[model samples]
Target: MPTGPTIIGFDADDTLWHNEPFFRMTQERFAELLRDHADPDHLMERLLEAERRNLGHYGFGIKGFVLTMIETAIEVTDGRVPASTISHLLNEGREMLRHPVDLLPGAEDTVRQLSQTHVLIMITKGDLLDQERKLAESGLGDLFDGVEIVSDKKAATYTRAFADHGDGAQAGLMVGNSMKSDVIPAIEAGAWGVFCPSEQEWALERADPPVAAPRYHEIASLHELPDLVKTL
Candidate 1:
């Protein structure tokens, strides 16, 4: 494999490390707390609805997650919830915050390999402090020459990344699990994209399939990336 693009952007959450499982654990505990007031499935649905609606107001991270649990408790329990339950919810949210970070298998090796031939950047979106902490703990922080931890990975971010990094489209590629956030914007900005799907990315966060001649490649694993890069 030969170098495909000079600059390759990788997503950080589930794409590079373990993330969604912690959120799912918190949600399950939330349902348990509210089970007396509502069915578990109904509680989950309502909680998800609140999260979607509150994303604009609260954004992502522990703060938004706490609000979702509080709001869900009030809604399902008709504001009659025990004070202890609120305490429990807060504790759970904090526990979510303290969950130890771990990287996906082979992430370090794959990133290291890709870095040998191409410039590597970590392009991730999340609460600033939490994202930074995770990156620091991953032990691959030094591997990335540049890191873009933004609130969103929209078209403008991709454009800036390309322009700031090098000459133009030919030099950049975006790789990640979310098609919506990672691939589409990169492609729209005239950069190549590599899609590596994860089981738990937000469905709405996915990018639609390319409408024009393909400017992206879909891969199964980061370990397969060396071969992909060779062909690029």
Candidate 2:
């Protein structure tokens, strides 16, 4: 194994920029739109359930999320949801897709610093077009050796990403906010997994860390990453 990770992967959404907040804001608006049909809390619960249930069919991203919201609205209203309400939900999804890419604190500098010594790659899961747009807008695109806009983050996916870009498995390091998508799977694939918690986490992506994993690490922020990587 290498003395340290030769390839570093980053999760793009909440990890690189402000992402979940947009989704949360949209959900709040959604709850208000359907307040007449159900309590906001109940509506949110239903919407979350819908998103979770539809994950397999729709995969992940704003497009899938919008579809689930439409389904939830119809389900909550017993198929009586107004056409205007549906239109509004679709508009909301468009707005989310158009939302600006706001980089997280220290993300750019840290990545730039790490890129000097190690290969840096972005491994994000979402709609490809939207993700590509964000990367284009982020101004950090040139910093990466490669970018992997994946449907999901699994051990196999991590393994492949590493094999293609790095020395493979033990020579890779994955960093992101979601423990489920960024940390565990990478660690399971024999790479180091570093968790940098985000301000807002999507319910579906939440999970407890593998505390006993020797390569699993949790940091307070991306600001701490360069030093950590140096020490590793």
Candidate 3:
């Protein structure tokens, strides 16, 4: 018999650990390197646009980002960029690979406590290899009974995930940083959605507010979740 929520889905990137900060850092460096010729904000906008367009093709993660940077460099520079720019991009890619993996303040412990009561699932969208490595390194891999690495998070993604976990839409809750990808979609699929806002934003386009949000709740920290679940 299910005691708490039957299924709990978590977003892995910024929700689980530090993700966007690294991207922002890399972007800033990219801008500084190209500041002599181009506007940083415009360059960032272009890069983000490219990433959005390529979401289906490359998915999310450092590798896709690196590729986008390379492509953006080529496009913006019209192949006039020197070898040093290419080398800098390559070095940044390597740095992304080497960045330390640190779990969010309450992520590990919160997951541990929740795992004991509910069926925990990690439903993240990103590059396959990097996500796998992060999960393995985060030391929370075994805590989740199910792990899903998806290319995108939408209504379809959540619907498939809920079905796959045998939750069948009932007693399902999604916890994550994005209101667009995680909260709205999961709630639309007949699951409860808990939005935990992060400092970083995921997409260039924001998700429209749900027409009906009876099952949606937003919390500040993961530590507050277990208790909230008990009340729901």
Q: Residue 10 lDDT in model 1? A: 89
For residues 109-167, could you state the per-residue lDDT of candidate 3 as single tens digits? 89999899888899997778788888999999999989999877888888888888856
lDDT for 214 (candidate 3): 80
Tens-digit lDDT track for model 2 on 1-232?
Answer: 4598899999999888999999999999999999899999888888888888999999999999999999999999999999999999999999999999999999899988998999999999999999999999999999999999998999999999999997998899999999999999999999999999998888888999999999999999999999888877
Cα-based RMSD of candidate 2: 0.8
User: Per-residue error at 49 for model 3, in Å?
Assistant: 1.9
From the highest lDDT down, the ranking of the candidates is 2, 3, 1
Candidate 3: global Cα-lDDT? Answer: 0.84
Q: What is the per-residue lDDT of model 1 for residues 74-107, given as tens digits with 9 covering 90 to 100?
A: 9888899899999998998778777778888768
Off by more than 4 A, model 1: 1-3, 211-213
Using alpha carbons, what is the TM-score of model 1? 0.92
Off by more than 4 A, model 3: 1-4, 203-205, 208-212
TM-score (all chains, Cα) for each model: 0.92, 0.98, 0.93
Better of 2 and 3 by TM-score: 2
Model 3: pairs clashing at backbone N, Cα or C within 3 Å: none
* Candidate 2 structure, TM-score to reference: 0.98
